[model samples]
Target chain A: AQSVTQPDIHITVSEGASLELRCNYSYGATPYLFWYVQSPGQGLQLLLKYFSGDTLVQGIKGFEAEFKRSQSSFNLRKPSVHWSDAAEYFCAVVASGTASKLTFGTGTRLQVTL
Target chain B: DTAVSQTPKYLVTQMGNDKSIKCEQNLGHDTMYWYKQDSKKFLKIMFSYNNKELIINETVPNRFSPKSPDKAHLNLHINSLELGDSAVYFCASSPFDRNTEAFFGQGTRLTVV
Candidate 1:
């Protein structure tokens, strides 16, 4: 079974400061990785996805993620975060064969300070 | 227009009552799914349908039933809802291709009191 682990339960960052949310996955084969953001009372929105090639994947709202095979990790990064970026972030994984079945982590709540 | 939409964004009902959440996708995707987000913000797939055919049914309780009348619509019906069932339910759709990403709806927050 494929599982995603987001070790940070919550993170607080000052506005305009750099941010990184760590995500680790355990899968037997190559995994399809994704990052999703959910605002308060809103549904999850796809930030970006990693299918193949180009380990460095860019996403919406000036966000990006790097997939490191050796570390079994796909961490989301931003050079600077805005107050609106504060939300619950989830790291998800899709097994090689099962595309529709997305296994998500417990999620990381991001709080941006002004 | 919303790519994926679910009816009754907020549903508050008493325990032991039955309710249904309807989902429709305008993206014309072939696969649709229902996902549950618990209070702790853990998301898990509950059911999936491909071309109106049941494809994946996770270890969810039988009280939770999903119906797909067509490829573009998927509805979830819960029977005798329990307090534990209070969570946000999301509907999503995606192409049949393995590399495609799923588009999610606004979600239906079901509260059982």
Candidate 2:
């Protein structure tokens, strides 16, 4: 079974600080990976995705994630996080392009402080 | 404009009462889904429909019925609601398949008294 694990349940960082949210997946083969953000009482918004690429994928709001095949990880990173970036982050993996059912992680709640 | 929307954002009902939550998407996507988020914050997929056809049905109770009228609308009807039925239900739609990012609704909070 495909599964995703996010060790950090919650994280606190100061404004303008670099941020890194870790994500790991267990799958039989290379699967479609994605990162999404959700604000309180709001729906989820796609942050980034990785399929077949240069390993480093860039996304909206200055967010980026690197696909480390060896490590089975797709960790999200941002050079500088804005206050508006405070939200819950989720990492997901689909079995394949055709069997597109996503398995999501528990989620990481990010808190940005001044 | 809301891409995906669900009606009755908050629902409070009795344990034995039956209720249905409506969902619609204007993105013209071919696939729609229903997910449940438990009190422990664990999100799980319950049902999925593609072009009004049932595609994926997880290990959900038969009391939970999902109906898709068209390619853009999917509704969830719960029968004989129980205390465990109290959770946040999310509706989502995707264009081609799950490979693409799935657009989600604001979610509906269902509480069984």
Q: Which window of 10 residues has the lowest lDDT sum in candidate 2 chain A?
A: A94-103
- For B31-82, candidate 2 gives per-residue lDDT tens digits of 8989898886677889888889988899999999999988989999999999
Model 2: residues with Cα > 4 Å off, grouped in runs: A97-99
Candidate 2 C-alpha lDDT tens digits along A1-114: 899999999999999999999999999987789998989877788899988868999999999999999999999999999999999999998865453677899999999999
State the fnat of model 1: 0.71
**How many clashing residue pairs appear in each of the predictions shown?**
0, 0
Candidate 1 residue lDDT tens string, B36-105: 9999989999998999998898899999999999999999999999999999999999998778789999
> In candidate 1 chain A, what residue range of length 10 has the lowest lDDT sum?
A93-102
Which pairs of residues collide in model 2?
none
